[model samples]
Target chain A: MIGIKELRAGDSLPEVRLNPVTRLDLIKYAGASGDFNPIHTIDAEAEQAGLPGIIAHGMWTMGNLAKLFTPYLEQGFIREYAIRFRGMVFLGDVVTLKAVLKDLQDQELTFEVAAVNHDGQDVLKGSVVFSAELPDL
Target chain B: MLKDSIGKRSEKVRNTIERGAVRKFAEAIGDPAPIFIDEAAGAESVYKRNIAPPTFPVTFDAGVIPELDLPSKGLIHGEQIYTYVRPLLVGETVYCWMEVKDYYERSGKMGRMGFLVMTKYGENANGELLFTEERIVIISEAVRKGMGA
Candidate 1:
Protein backbone atom coordinates (compact mmCIF):
# COMPACT_ATOMS: atom_id res chain seq x y z
CA MET A 1 0.00 0.00 0.00
CA ILE A 2 1.19 3.57 -0.77
CA GLY A 3 1.49 5.99 2.11
CA ILE A 4 0.85 9.38 0.65
CA LYS A 5 2.61 11.12 3.53
CA GLU A 6 5.80 9.14 3.18
CA LEU A 7 5.94 9.16 -0.60
CA ARG A 8 8.90 10.95 -2.21
CA ALA A 9 9.45 12.19 -5.69
CA GLY A 10 11.72 9.27 -6.59
CA ASP A 11 9.66 6.49 -5.07
CA SER A 12 8.28 3.87 -7.40
CA LEU A 13 4.95 2.30 -6.68
CA PRO A 14 4.84 -1.47 -6.23
CA GLU A 15 4.71 -3.02 -9.67
CA VAL A 16 1.66 -4.97 -10.79
CA ARG A 17 2.08 -7.77 -13.33
CA LEU A 18 -1.12 -8.97 -14.94
CA ASN A 19 -1.79 -12.47 -16.17
CA PRO A 20 -1.65 -13.22 -19.89
CA VAL A 21 -4.38 -11.38 -21.78
CA THR A 22 -7.21 -13.69 -22.81
CA ARG A 23 -10.15 -13.60 -25.20
CA LEU A 24 -12.68 -13.80 -22.38
CA ASP A 25 -11.11 -10.73 -20.80
CA LEU A 26 -11.49 -8.79 -24.02
CA ILE A 27 -15.06 -9.95 -24.45
CA LYS A 28 -15.95 -8.91 -20.94
CA TYR A 29 -14.29 -5.53 -21.41
CA ALA A 30 -16.01 -4.99 -24.75
CA GLY A 31 -19.39 -5.65 -23.21
CA ALA A 32 -18.74 -3.50 -20.17
CA SER A 33 -17.25 -0.55 -22.07
CA GLY A 34 -19.75 -0.75 -24.94
CA ASP A 35 -16.78 -0.74 -27.31
CA PHE A 36 -17.91 -3.64 -29.47
CA ASN A 37 -15.10 -3.27 -31.94
CA PRO A 38 -14.62 -6.71 -33.53
CA ILE A 39 -10.88 -6.23 -33.87
CA HIS A 40 -10.59 -6.64 -30.17
CA THR A 41 -12.58 -9.85 -29.89
CA ILE A 42 -12.75 -11.83 -33.10
CA ASP A 43 -9.59 -13.33 -34.53
CA ALA A 44 -11.04 -13.61 -38.02
CA GLU A 45 -12.18 -10.02 -37.89
CA ALA A 46 -8.75 -8.88 -36.81
CA GLU A 47 -7.08 -10.78 -39.64
CA GLN A 48 -9.59 -9.37 -42.05
CA ALA A 49 -8.66 -5.92 -40.84
CA GLY A 50 -4.97 -6.66 -41.51
CA LEU A 51 -3.94 -7.36 -37.95
CA PRO A 52 -2.06 -10.49 -36.95
CA GLY A 53 -4.80 -11.58 -34.53
CA ILE A 54 -7.27 -10.22 -32.06
CA ILE A 55 -5.76 -7.35 -30.07
CA ALA A 56 -6.74 -6.03 -26.68
CA HIS A 57 -8.70 -2.81 -26.58
CA GLY A 58 -6.41 0.08 -25.78
CA MET A 59 -8.89 1.27 -23.15
CA TRP A 60 -8.75 -2.14 -21.48
CA THR A 61 -5.04 -1.77 -20.89
CA MET A 62 -5.53 1.85 -19.86
CA GLY A 63 -8.25 0.90 -17.38
CA ASN A 64 -6.12 -1.73 -15.71
CA LEU A 65 -3.31 0.76 -15.23
CA ALA A 66 -5.46 2.47 -12.62
CA LYS A 67 -5.04 -0.54 -10.35
CA LEU A 68 -1.79 0.89 -9.11
CA PHE A 69 -3.77 3.46 -7.13
CA THR A 70 -6.48 1.14 -5.84
CA PRO A 71 -4.66 0.46 -2.57
CA TYR A 72 -4.23 4.15 -1.82
CA LEU A 73 -7.70 5.45 -2.51
CA GLU A 74 -8.07 6.73 1.02
CA GLN A 75 -5.33 9.25 0.43
CA GLY A 76 -6.97 10.84 -2.61
CA PHE A 77 -8.34 10.27 -6.07
CA ILE A 78 -6.79 10.35 -9.50
CA ARG A 79 -7.24 13.87 -10.82
CA GLU A 80 -5.59 13.45 -14.20
CA TYR A 81 -4.48 10.56 -16.37
CA ALA A 82 -2.78 10.80 -19.76
CA ILE A 83 -1.42 7.97 -21.84
CA ARG A 84 -0.19 7.20 -25.36
CA PHE A 85 -0.40 3.81 -27.01
CA ARG A 86 3.10 2.96 -28.15
CA GLY A 87 2.55 -0.60 -29.31
CA MET A 88 -0.13 -3.22 -29.67
CA VAL A 89 -1.12 -5.62 -26.90
CA PHE A 90 -1.96 -9.06 -28.22
CA LEU A 91 -3.71 -11.99 -26.62
CA GLY A 92 -1.53 -13.88 -24.14
CA ASP A 93 0.75 -10.93 -23.50
CA VAL A 94 1.50 -10.25 -19.85
CA VAL A 95 1.61 -6.52 -19.09
CA THR A 96 3.55 -5.03 -16.22
CA LEU A 97 2.38 -1.70 -14.78
CA LYS A 98 4.85 0.68 -13.21
CA ALA A 99 4.83 4.25 -11.87
CA VAL A 100 7.40 6.56 -10.29
CA LEU A 101 6.53 9.62 -8.31
CA LYS A 102 7.74 12.58 -10.36
CA ASP A 103 6.73 15.55 -8.24
CA LEU A 104 4.62 16.62 -5.30
CA GLN A 105 3.20 20.09 -4.93
CA ASP A 106 0.65 21.10 -2.37
CA GLN A 107 -2.08 18.43 -2.50
CA GLU A 108 -1.13 17.08 -5.91
CA LEU A 109 1.37 14.35 -6.66
CA THR A 110 2.39 13.50 -10.20
CA PHE A 111 3.87 10.20 -11.37
CA GLU A 112 5.32 9.01 -14.62
CA VAL A 113 3.72 5.71 -15.58
CA ALA A 114 4.15 2.98 -18.16
CA ALA A 115 2.86 -0.47 -19.11
CA VAL A 116 5.34 -2.95 -20.54
CA ASN A 117 4.69 -6.31 -22.12
CA HIS A 118 6.36 -9.56 -21.10
CA ASP A 119 9.06 -9.01 -23.68
CA GLY A 120 10.03 -5.69 -22.00
CA GLN A 121 8.46 -3.45 -24.61
CA ASP A 122 6.41 -0.47 -23.53
CA VAL A 123 2.88 -0.82 -24.83
CA LEU A 124 1.76 2.43 -23.20
CA LYS A 125 3.42 5.42 -21.51
CA GLY A 126 2.11 8.50 -19.74
CA SER A 127 1.68 10.31 -16.45
CA VAL A 128 -0.97 10.36 -13.76
CA VAL A 129 -1.73 13.11 -11.26
CA PHE A 130 -3.11 12.09 -7.88
CA SER A 131 -4.66 14.69 -5.66
CA ALA A 132 -3.95 14.05 -2.02
CA GLU A 133 -6.88 16.10 -0.93
CA LEU A 134 -10.30 16.39 -2.49
CA PRO A 135 -11.08 20.03 -3.04
CA ASP A 136 -14.40 21.67 -2.30
CA LEU A 137 -16.84 21.32 -5.18
CA MET B 1 -12.67 16.39 -45.78
CA LEU B 2 -11.81 15.21 -42.29
CA LYS B 3 -10.26 18.57 -41.53
CA ASP B 4 -13.57 20.25 -42.15
CA SER B 5 -15.04 18.47 -39.16
CA ILE B 6 -12.59 20.12 -36.80
CA GLY B 7 -14.35 22.09 -34.05
CA LYS B 8 -17.64 20.26 -34.64
CA ARG B 9 -19.45 19.44 -31.41
CA SER B 10 -21.80 16.52 -30.94
CA GLU B 11 -25.18 16.49 -29.29
CA LYS B 12 -25.31 16.06 -25.54
CA VAL B 13 -26.08 12.53 -24.37
CA ARG B 14 -27.30 11.96 -20.84
CA ASN B 15 -26.22 8.93 -18.81
CA THR B 16 -27.13 7.72 -15.36
CA ILE B 17 -24.35 6.14 -13.35
CA GLU B 18 -26.03 3.00 -12.06
CA ARG B 19 -24.70 0.81 -9.29
CA GLY B 20 -24.98 -2.37 -11.32
CA ALA B 21 -23.11 -0.87 -14.24
CA VAL B 22 -20.41 0.41 -11.93
CA ARG B 23 -20.06 -3.01 -10.39
CA LYS B 24 -19.84 -4.66 -13.78
CA PHE B 25 -17.22 -2.18 -14.91
CA ALA B 26 -15.19 -2.76 -11.80
CA GLU B 27 -15.44 -6.51 -12.23
CA ALA B 28 -14.49 -6.33 -15.89
CA ILE B 29 -11.34 -4.40 -15.06
CA GLY B 30 -10.54 -7.05 -12.40
CA ASP B 31 -10.47 -4.38 -9.67
CA PRO B 32 -12.44 -5.65 -6.70
CA ALA B 33 -11.80 -2.71 -4.42
CA PRO B 34 -14.41 -2.71 -1.70
CA ILE B 35 -15.03 0.98 -2.21
CA PHE B 36 -16.24 0.19 -5.68
CA ILE B 37 -18.32 -2.93 -4.96
CA ASP B 38 -19.21 -3.19 -1.27
CA GLU B 39 -21.73 -0.74 0.14
CA ALA B 40 -20.49 -1.02 3.70
CA ALA B 41 -16.93 -0.21 2.69
CA GLY B 42 -18.15 2.76 0.72
CA ALA B 43 -20.12 4.04 3.66
CA GLU B 44 -16.91 3.98 5.66
CA SER B 45 -14.77 5.62 3.03
CA VAL B 46 -13.95 9.31 2.86
CA TYR B 47 -16.40 9.86 0.05
CA LYS B 48 -19.15 8.31 2.21
CA ARG B 49 -20.45 6.67 -0.94
CA ASN B 50 -19.28 4.33 -3.63
CA ILE B 51 -17.26 6.26 -6.15
CA ALA B 52 -16.62 5.15 -9.71
CA PRO B 53 -13.11 4.41 -10.87
CA PRO B 54 -11.17 7.15 -12.60
CA THR B 55 -11.42 5.38 -15.92
CA PHE B 56 -15.07 4.52 -15.55
CA PRO B 57 -16.10 7.48 -17.68
CA VAL B 58 -15.19 5.43 -20.72
CA THR B 59 -18.58 3.73 -20.36
CA PHE B 60 -20.46 7.00 -20.82
CA ASP B 61 -22.08 7.71 -24.16
CA ALA B 62 -19.93 10.45 -25.69
CA GLY B 63 -22.21 11.64 -28.47
CA VAL B 64 -20.70 11.30 -31.92
CA ILE B 65 -20.22 13.84 -34.69
CA PRO B 66 -21.65 12.66 -38.01
CA GLU B 67 -18.91 14.36 -39.97
CA LEU B 68 -16.21 12.00 -38.62
CA ASP B 69 -17.27 9.34 -41.13
CA LEU B 70 -14.75 6.96 -39.62
CA PRO B 71 -14.58 3.44 -40.93
CA SER B 72 -16.25 1.00 -38.62
CA LYS B 73 -13.29 -1.33 -38.63
CA GLY B 74 -9.53 -0.73 -38.25
CA LEU B 75 -9.77 2.47 -36.24
CA ILE B 76 -7.06 2.48 -33.59
CA HIS B 77 -7.15 4.17 -30.20
CA GLY B 78 -3.87 6.04 -30.18
CA GLU B 79 -4.01 8.19 -27.06
CA GLN B 80 -6.26 9.20 -24.17
CA ILE B 81 -6.19 11.81 -21.43
CA TYR B 82 -8.69 12.47 -18.65
CA THR B 83 -8.87 15.53 -16.44
CA TYR B 84 -11.31 15.19 -13.59
CA VAL B 85 -12.81 17.85 -11.39
CA ARG B 86 -13.68 15.07 -8.98
CA PRO B 87 -14.50 11.39 -8.84
CA LEU B 88 -17.93 10.55 -10.21
CA LEU B 89 -20.38 9.27 -7.60
CA VAL B 90 -22.70 6.41 -8.34
CA GLY B 91 -26.30 7.42 -9.09
CA GLU B 92 -25.40 10.79 -10.52
CA THR B 93 -26.76 11.72 -13.90
CA VAL B 94 -24.12 13.09 -16.25
CA TYR B 95 -24.52 14.89 -19.56
CA CYS B 96 -21.85 13.86 -22.00
CA TRP B 97 -20.80 15.37 -25.33
CA MET B 98 -17.81 15.50 -27.65
CA GLU B 99 -16.04 17.94 -29.96
CA VAL B 100 -13.61 17.39 -32.78
CA LYS B 101 -10.43 19.19 -31.73
CA ASP B 102 -8.23 18.57 -34.74
CA TYR B 103 -7.31 16.16 -37.56
CA TYR B 104 -4.17 15.48 -39.55
CA GLU B 105 -2.41 12.76 -41.51
CA ARG B 106 1.10 11.42 -41.21
CA SER B 107 3.19 8.66 -42.78
CA GLY B 108 4.52 5.99 -40.48
CA LYS B 109 6.35 2.74 -41.00
CA MET B 110 3.09 0.84 -41.41
CA GLY B 111 1.81 3.36 -44.02
CA ARG B 112 -0.16 6.58 -44.05
CA MET B 113 -2.16 7.25 -40.89
CA GLY B 114 -4.74 9.89 -40.04
CA PHE B 115 -5.06 11.19 -36.50
CA LEU B 116 -8.41 12.44 -35.30
CA VAL B 117 -8.29 14.32 -32.03
CA MET B 118 -11.48 14.79 -30.02
CA THR B 119 -12.43 15.98 -26.56
CA LYS B 120 -15.39 14.64 -24.61
CA TYR B 121 -16.98 16.42 -21.70
CA GLY B 122 -19.08 15.20 -18.76
CA GLU B 123 -21.13 17.56 -16.68
CA ASN B 124 -23.52 17.35 -13.77
CA ALA B 125 -27.26 17.94 -13.95
CA ASN B 126 -26.57 21.54 -12.93
CA GLY B 127 -24.33 21.96 -15.95
CA GLU B 128 -21.12 22.12 -13.98
CA LEU B 129 -18.16 20.44 -15.60
CA LEU B 130 -17.15 17.14 -14.05
CA PHE B 131 -14.47 15.87 -16.34
CA THR B 132 -12.99 16.18 -19.80
CA GLU B 133 -11.53 13.34 -21.84
CA GLU B 134 -9.29 13.99 -24.84
CA ARG B 135 -8.53 11.13 -27.15
CA ILE B 136 -6.72 10.54 -30.41
CA VAL B 137 -8.07 7.92 -32.79
CA ILE B 138 -5.83 6.68 -35.58
CA ILE B 139 -7.10 5.82 -39.04
CA SER B 140 -4.76 3.81 -41.15
CA GLU B 141 -4.45 4.31 -44.88
CA ALA B 142 -5.77 0.83 -45.46
CA VAL B 143 -9.00 1.57 -43.65
CA ARG B 144 -9.41 4.86 -45.50
CA LYS B 145 -8.84 3.10 -48.82
CA GLY B 146 -11.34 0.44 -47.85
CA MET B 147 -13.89 3.17 -47.27
CA GLY B 148 -13.12 4.67 -50.70
CA ALA B 149 -13.84 8.12 -49.27
Candidate 2:
Protein backbone atom coordinates (compact mmCIF):
# COMPACT_ATOMS: atom_id res chain seq x y z
CA MET A 1 0.00 0.00 0.00
CA ILE A 2 1.23 3.52 -0.83
CA GLY A 3 0.96 6.19 1.75
CA ILE A 4 0.04 9.76 0.93
CA LYS A 5 3.25 10.99 2.52
CA GLU A 6 5.36 8.73 0.34
CA LEU A 7 3.86 9.79 -2.95
CA ARG A 8 5.87 12.02 -5.30
CA ALA A 9 5.54 13.25 -8.84
CA GLY A 10 7.37 11.06 -11.34
CA ASP A 11 7.41 7.92 -9.15
CA SER A 12 6.28 4.80 -10.99
CA LEU A 13 4.03 2.20 -9.48
CA PRO A 14 4.71 -1.52 -9.68
CA GLU A 15 3.81 -2.92 -13.11
CA VAL A 16 0.90 -5.35 -13.28
CA ARG A 17 1.03 -8.07 -15.93
CA LEU A 18 -2.36 -9.63 -16.59
CA ASN A 19 -2.98 -13.16 -17.83
CA PRO A 20 -3.67 -13.55 -21.55
CA VAL A 21 -7.07 -12.35 -22.73
CA THR A 22 -9.53 -15.23 -22.97
CA ARG A 23 -12.99 -15.80 -24.41
CA LEU A 24 -14.30 -16.85 -21.02
CA ASP A 25 -13.00 -13.64 -19.49
CA LEU A 26 -14.89 -11.58 -22.05
CA ILE A 27 -18.04 -13.64 -21.50
CA LYS A 28 -17.85 -13.06 -17.75
CA TYR A 29 -17.26 -9.38 -18.34
CA ALA A 30 -20.23 -9.18 -20.69
CA GLY A 31 -22.51 -10.63 -18.04
CA ALA A 32 -21.16 -8.37 -15.32
CA SER A 33 -21.13 -5.15 -17.34
CA GLY A 34 -24.47 -5.82 -19.08
CA ASP A 35 -22.78 -5.04 -22.40
CA PHE A 36 -23.86 -8.08 -24.42
CA ASN A 37 -22.21 -6.91 -27.61
CA PRO A 38 -21.49 -10.09 -29.56
CA ILE A 39 -18.33 -8.67 -31.10
CA HIS A 40 -16.68 -9.00 -27.75
CA THR A 41 -17.63 -12.64 -27.24
CA ILE A 42 -18.76 -14.80 -30.17
CA ASP A 43 -16.20 -15.49 -32.88
CA ALA A 44 -18.87 -15.92 -35.52
CA GLU A 45 -20.47 -12.61 -34.63
CA ALA A 46 -17.11 -10.86 -34.74
CA GLU A 47 -16.24 -12.36 -38.13
CA GLN A 48 -19.61 -11.37 -39.49
CA ALA A 49 -18.97 -7.83 -38.26
CA GLY A 50 -15.66 -7.76 -40.19
CA LEU A 51 -13.36 -8.22 -37.21
CA PRO A 52 -10.73 -10.95 -37.29
CA GLY A 53 -12.07 -12.51 -34.09
CA ILE A 54 -13.57 -11.74 -30.74
CA ILE A 55 -12.27 -8.59 -29.04
CA ALA A 56 -12.21 -7.50 -25.41
CA HIS A 57 -14.59 -4.83 -24.22
CA GLY A 58 -12.92 -1.43 -23.81
CA MET A 59 -14.50 -1.15 -20.38
CA TRP A 60 -12.95 -4.46 -19.32
CA THR A 61 -9.47 -3.15 -19.93
CA MET A 62 -10.38 0.15 -18.27
CA GLY A 63 -11.71 -1.71 -15.23
CA ASN A 64 -8.54 -3.74 -14.83
CA LEU A 65 -6.51 -0.54 -15.02
CA ALA A 66 -8.06 0.37 -11.68
CA LYS A 67 -6.26 -2.57 -10.12
CA LEU A 68 -3.15 -0.43 -10.03
CA PHE A 69 -4.83 1.75 -7.42
CA THR A 70 -6.17 -1.08 -5.24
CA PRO A 71 -3.26 -0.88 -2.84
CA TYR A 72 -3.75 2.86 -2.46
CA LEU A 73 -7.42 2.57 -1.62
CA GLU A 74 -6.77 2.86 2.05
CA GLN A 75 -5.05 6.14 1.44
CA GLY A 76 -7.49 7.55 -1.08
CA PHE A 77 -10.17 6.85 -3.65
CA ILE A 78 -10.10 7.41 -7.37
CA ARG A 79 -11.80 10.75 -7.99
CA GLU A 80 -11.65 10.73 -11.79
CA TYR A 81 -10.62 8.46 -14.65
CA ALA A 82 -10.42 9.15 -18.39
CA ILE A 83 -9.13 7.08 -21.27
CA ARG A 84 -9.05 6.82 -25.05
CA PHE A 85 -9.25 3.49 -26.84
CA ARG A 86 -6.09 3.44 -28.92
CA GLY A 87 -6.07 -0.15 -30.23
CA MET A 88 -7.90 -3.46 -29.96
CA VAL A 89 -7.12 -6.25 -27.54
CA PHE A 90 -7.42 -9.63 -29.23
CA LEU A 91 -7.71 -13.12 -27.77
CA GLY A 92 -4.53 -14.64 -26.34
CA ASP A 93 -3.04 -11.17 -25.99
CA VAL A 94 -1.48 -10.30 -22.65
CA VAL A 95 -1.85 -6.75 -21.34
CA THR A 96 0.45 -4.83 -19.03
CA LEU A 97 -0.71 -1.91 -16.86
CA LYS A 98 1.53 0.99 -15.91
CA ALA A 99 1.03 4.25 -14.03
CA VAL A 100 3.36 7.09 -13.15
CA LEU A 101 2.56 9.82 -10.68
CA LYS A 102 2.27 13.03 -12.70
CA ASP A 103 1.26 15.61 -10.15
CA LEU A 104 0.59 16.12 -6.45
CA GLN A 105 -1.47 18.99 -5.13
CA ASP A 106 -3.92 19.56 -2.30
CA GLN A 107 -4.14 15.88 -1.44
CA GLU A 108 -4.89 14.89 -5.03
CA LEU A 109 -2.38 12.84 -6.99
CA THR A 110 -2.66 12.65 -10.75
CA PHE A 111 -1.19 9.69 -12.54
CA GLU A 112 -0.46 9.07 -16.21
CA VAL A 113 -1.67 5.57 -16.99
CA ALA A 114 -1.56 3.23 -19.96
CA ALA A 115 -2.40 -0.36 -20.88
CA VAL A 116 0.07 -1.90 -23.31
CA ASN A 117 -0.52 -5.07 -25.28
CA HIS A 118 2.00 -7.87 -25.84
CA ASP A 119 3.28 -6.12 -28.94
CA GLY A 120 4.23 -3.03 -26.90
CA GLN A 121 1.32 -1.20 -28.47
CA ASP A 122 -0.92 0.89 -26.29
CA VAL A 123 -4.46 -0.41 -26.25
CA LEU A 124 -5.65 2.30 -23.84
CA LYS A 125 -4.18 5.46 -22.34
CA GLY A 126 -5.52 7.94 -19.82
CA SER A 127 -5.16 9.78 -16.54
CA VAL A 128 -6.45 9.10 -13.04
CA VAL A 129 -6.88 11.48 -10.12
CA PHE A 130 -6.75 10.01 -6.61
CA SER A 131 -7.97 12.04 -3.67
CA ALA A 132 -6.51 11.61 -0.21
CA GLU A 133 -5.88 13.64 2.96
CA LEU A 134 -2.42 15.07 2.99
CA PRO A 135 -0.57 15.56 6.24
CA ASP A 136 -0.78 19.14 7.48
CA LEU A 137 2.36 21.10 6.76
CA MET B 1 -29.24 14.45 -38.62
CA LEU B 2 -27.45 13.21 -35.47
CA LYS B 3 -26.76 16.81 -34.53
CA ASP B 4 -30.36 17.23 -33.45
CA SER B 5 -29.66 15.03 -30.44
CA ILE B 6 -27.20 17.52 -28.95
CA GLY B 7 -29.59 18.61 -26.20
CA LYS B 8 -31.69 15.49 -25.92
CA ARG B 9 -31.89 13.67 -22.58
CA SER B 10 -33.23 10.27 -21.67
CA GLU B 11 -35.62 9.18 -18.96
CA LYS B 12 -34.08 8.56 -15.57
CA VAL B 13 -33.62 4.93 -14.56
CA ARG B 14 -33.21 3.63 -11.01
CA ASN B 15 -30.53 1.07 -10.23
CA THR B 16 -29.69 -0.77 -7.06
CA ILE B 17 -26.06 -1.50 -6.43
CA GLU B 18 -26.26 -5.20 -5.61
CA ARG B 19 -23.49 -6.92 -3.68
CA GLY B 20 -23.51 -10.01 -5.89
CA ALA B 21 -23.14 -7.97 -9.06
CA VAL B 22 -20.37 -5.89 -7.53
CA ARG B 23 -18.47 -9.03 -6.61
CA LYS B 24 -18.90 -10.44 -10.06
CA PHE B 25 -17.68 -7.24 -11.65
CA ALA B 26 -14.66 -7.08 -9.39
CA GLU B 27 -13.83 -10.70 -10.15
CA ALA B 28 -14.31 -10.30 -13.89
CA ILE B 29 -11.72 -7.55 -13.89
CA GLY B 30 -9.30 -9.93 -12.11
CA ASP B 31 -9.22 -7.68 -9.06
CA PRO B 32 -9.51 -9.73 -5.89
CA ALA B 33 -9.73 -6.68 -3.62
CA PRO B 34 -11.11 -7.78 -0.29
CA ILE B 35 -12.92 -4.48 0.19
CA PHE B 36 -15.04 -5.33 -2.82
CA ILE B 37 -15.80 -8.98 -2.00
CA ASP B 38 -15.05 -9.95 1.61
CA GLU B 39 -17.60 -8.51 4.03
CA ALA B 40 -15.42 -8.88 7.09
CA ALA B 41 -12.56 -7.14 5.35
CA GLY B 42 -14.89 -4.40 4.22
CA ALA B 43 -15.99 -3.76 7.81
CA GLU B 44 -12.35 -3.09 8.62
CA SER B 45 -11.80 -0.65 5.79
CA VAL B 46 -12.00 3.13 6.03
CA TYR B 47 -15.37 3.22 4.33
CA LYS B 48 -16.65 0.76 6.99
CA ARG B 49 -18.48 -1.14 4.27
CA ASN B 50 -18.05 -2.72 0.87
CA ILE B 51 -17.56 -0.29 -2.00
CA ALA B 52 -17.98 -0.76 -5.72
CA PRO B 53 -15.03 -0.38 -8.03
CA PRO B 54 -14.59 2.88 -9.91
CA THR B 55 -15.82 1.45 -13.19
CA PHE B 56 -18.78 -0.41 -11.68
CA PRO B 57 -21.29 2.21 -12.88
CA VAL B 58 -20.96 0.77 -16.39
CA THR B 59 -23.41 -1.88 -15.22
CA PHE B 60 -26.09 0.70 -14.51
CA ASP B 61 -28.73 1.26 -17.18
CA ALA B 62 -28.19 4.87 -18.16
CA GLY B 63 -31.31 5.45 -20.22
CA VAL B 64 -30.79 5.97 -23.93
CA ILE B 65 -31.93 8.94 -26.01
CA PRO B 66 -33.99 7.58 -28.89
CA GLU B 67 -33.05 10.27 -31.38
CA LEU B 68 -29.42 9.15 -31.39
CA ASP B 69 -30.58 6.09 -33.34
CA LEU B 70 -27.05 4.73 -33.42
CA PRO B 71 -26.27 1.74 -35.56
CA SER B 72 -26.20 -1.56 -33.74
CA LYS B 73 -23.06 -2.89 -35.41
CA GLY B 74 -19.48 -1.63 -35.86
CA LEU B 75 -19.86 1.21 -33.36
CA ILE B 76 -16.50 1.87 -31.78
CA HIS B 77 -16.19 3.12 -28.23
CA GLY B 78 -13.79 5.97 -28.82
CA GLU B 79 -13.24 7.54 -25.39
CA GLN B 80 -14.63 7.59 -21.87
CA ILE B 81 -14.35 9.71 -18.73
CA TYR B 82 -15.78 9.24 -15.25
CA THR B 83 -15.87 11.85 -12.51
CA TYR B 84 -16.99 10.73 -9.08
CA VAL B 85 -18.00 12.55 -5.93
CA ARG B 86 -17.41 9.44 -3.82
CA PRO B 87 -17.20 5.70 -4.07
CA LEU B 88 -20.56 3.97 -4.42
CA LEU B 89 -21.43 1.82 -1.41
CA VAL B 90 -22.96 -1.60 -1.76
CA GLY B 91 -26.75 -1.88 -1.43
CA GLU B 92 -27.28 1.76 -2.23
CA THR B 93 -29.94 2.84 -4.70
CA VAL B 94 -28.88 5.33 -7.33
CA TYR B 95 -30.79 6.92 -10.20
CA CYS B 96 -29.09 7.14 -13.56
CA TRP B 97 -29.71 8.99 -16.83
CA MET B 98 -27.94 10.05 -20.00
CA GLU B 99 -27.83 13.13 -22.23
CA VAL B 100 -26.35 13.88 -25.61
CA LYS B 101 -23.88 16.72 -25.09
CA ASP B 102 -22.67 17.10 -28.66
CA TYR B 103 -22.28 15.46 -32.07
CA TYR B 104 -20.09 16.00 -35.12
CA GLU B 105 -18.37 14.23 -37.99
CA ARG B 106 -14.80 13.83 -39.13
CA SER B 107 -13.03 12.00 -41.93
CA GLY B 108 -10.27 9.56 -41.14
CA LYS B 109 -8.54 6.59 -42.74
CA MET B 110 -11.68 4.61 -41.94
CA GLY B 111 -13.60 7.24 -43.96
CA ARG B 112 -16.32 9.46 -42.53
CA MET B 113 -16.88 8.98 -38.79
CA GLY B 114 -19.54 10.41 -36.55
CA PHE B 115 -18.50 11.30 -33.03
CA LEU B 116 -21.33 11.15 -30.54
CA VAL B 117 -20.50 12.74 -27.21
CA MET B 118 -22.81 11.99 -24.32
CA THR B 119 -22.88 12.21 -20.56
CA LYS B 120 -24.30 9.60 -18.19
CA TYR B 121 -25.21 10.67 -14.71
CA GLY B 122 -25.75 8.83 -11.41
CA GLU B 123 -27.45 10.50 -8.47
CA ASN B 124 -28.44 9.51 -4.95
CA ALA B 125 -31.99 8.72 -3.88
CA ASN B 126 -32.39 12.31 -2.72
CA GLY B 127 -31.48 13.52 -6.23
CA GLU B 128 -28.04 14.67 -5.23
CA LEU B 129 -25.50 14.26 -8.03
CA LEU B 130 -22.87 11.59 -7.48
CA PHE B 131 -20.98 11.03 -10.71
CA THR B 132 -20.93 11.85 -14.40
CA GLU B 133 -19.59 9.71 -17.24
CA GLU B 134 -18.60 11.43 -20.48
CA ARG B 135 -18.16 9.12 -23.44
CA ILE B 136 -17.52 9.47 -27.16
CA VAL B 137 -18.95 6.83 -29.48
CA ILE B 138 -17.52 6.67 -32.98
CA ILE B 139 -19.74 5.53 -35.84
CA SER B 140 -17.51 4.51 -38.72
CA GLU B 141 -18.28 4.98 -42.42
CA ALA B 142 -19.04 1.31 -42.90
CA VAL B 143 -21.59 1.35 -40.12
CA ARG B 144 -23.06 4.58 -41.47
CA LYS B 145 -23.38 3.10 -44.96
CA GLY B 146 -25.02 0.01 -43.48
CA MET B 147 -27.55 2.28 -41.81
CA GLY B 148 -27.93 4.12 -45.13
CA ALA B 149 -27.54 7.44 -43.38
Q: On residues B12-122, what C-alpha lDDT tens digit does candidate 1 reach at each position?
A: 999999999999898888897898988889889888888898889889997888766777767788899999988888888999999999999999898989899999999
| TM-score of predicted chain B versus true chain B for each candidate | 0.93, 0.94
Q: What's the lDDT for residue A12 in model 2?
A: 89
| Reference-based lDDT, each prediction | 0.89, 0.90
Name the candidate that leads on lDDT.
Answer: 2
Q: Enumerate residue pairs that collide in model 1.
A: none
Residue-level lDDT for A20 in candidate 1: 96
Give interface RMSD for all predictions.
1.1, 3.9
- Per-residue accuracy of model 1 over A10-104 as CA lDDT, tens digit each: 99999999999999999999998998999999989999988999999888898899889888887888999999999999999999999999999
User: Model 2 off-target regions past 4 Å?
Assistant: A134-137
Interface RMSD of candidate 2? 3.9
